[model samples]
Target: MQARLDQELARKGELIHRWSEGSLHEVDLIEEDYFTMLAALNRKVSSLRESIASLEGTPPPRVAPEELLANWTAGSLHQRRAILKRYLHSITVHPPLPSSQFDRAPLVKTRLAPHWKTAAEVTA
Candidate 1:
C-alpha cells in the first residue's frame, strides 16, 4: 500500500513538473487532474502514517506479580493459560531424587520472560 502510494505521488509530481514547464499537451485539464491526484495521494499518505503510528505506539502494560498470582489462583483455565503463555518462556520438571535426597532437591524450574528480571540481575 505504501509503495503504491509513493509511486502514485511520484507520478503526480512528474506531471506537475511537466505542466509547469509547458510540456503537457492539455494545460488546463492536466492542471486540474494533477491537483486532484495530489490531494488523493496526500490523503492516502496521511492515512498510512496514522496507521503506522497506531502500530508503533506503546505495548500493553505489564501485569503486576501480585495481581497475576491472584488471577492465576482464581481465574478460569483459559485465563490462567493466557497469563502463563504471556509471561513464562518454559518450565522444566525433573524426576524425584532418591528418598534420602528428595527433601533437598528441586523438582521444577521456570524461566520467566526477560522483562521479569530479578532485582539482583537488574542491579548487575
Candidate 2:
C-alpha cells in the first residue's frame, strides 16, 4: 500500500512536471484527473495505515488505572467509546435459554486487546 501510494505520488509529480513544461495540451483535464487520483490514493493510504496500526497493536500511552477510571466517569460518550475500543478486543454475550431457570445468569465474556496480551506475557 505504501508502495502504491509512493507510485501514485510520483505519477502526480510527473503530471505536474508535464503541465509546467507545456508538453500537455489538455492541461485542465490532466489537472482534474491528477487531483482525483491523488484524493483516492490519499484515502487508500490512510486506510492502509489504520489497518497496519490495528494489526501492530501498539500500546496506547501509559496512564494510571485511576486516570482511566476518572475518564470513564467524566468523559463524553465518544471519548469513552474510543477508550473501550483501544482496550477491548471484543465482548460476547450469550442469552439465557427460555427453558433455563429464571435464576440462571446470562454468560458474558470479554477479550482484552492484543497489546494487553503482550503486556501480560511480558509480566509473566
lDDT of 2 by residue, 1-124 (tens): 5576467556645654665576776645664554455445445644655555566775322445874675465445665776677666565545554564444333222221233334543222
For model 1, what is the error of residue 26's alpha carbon versus the real structure, in angstroms, after optimal superposition?
Answer: 78
Highest TM-score scorer: 2
Worst 10 residues of 2 by lDDT: 106-115
Model 1 misses residue 119 by how many Å? 15
RMSD of every prediction: 21.4, 15.6
Model 1 segments more than 4 A misplaced:
1-56, 104-124
The TM-score between candidate 2 and the true structure equals 0.35
Which lDDT values do the candidates have, in the order given? 0.53, 0.52
lDDT string for model 1 (1-124, tens) is 5576467557645755675677775545654564556456545654654555556773323335764565455444665666566555565555566777555433432222234434443222
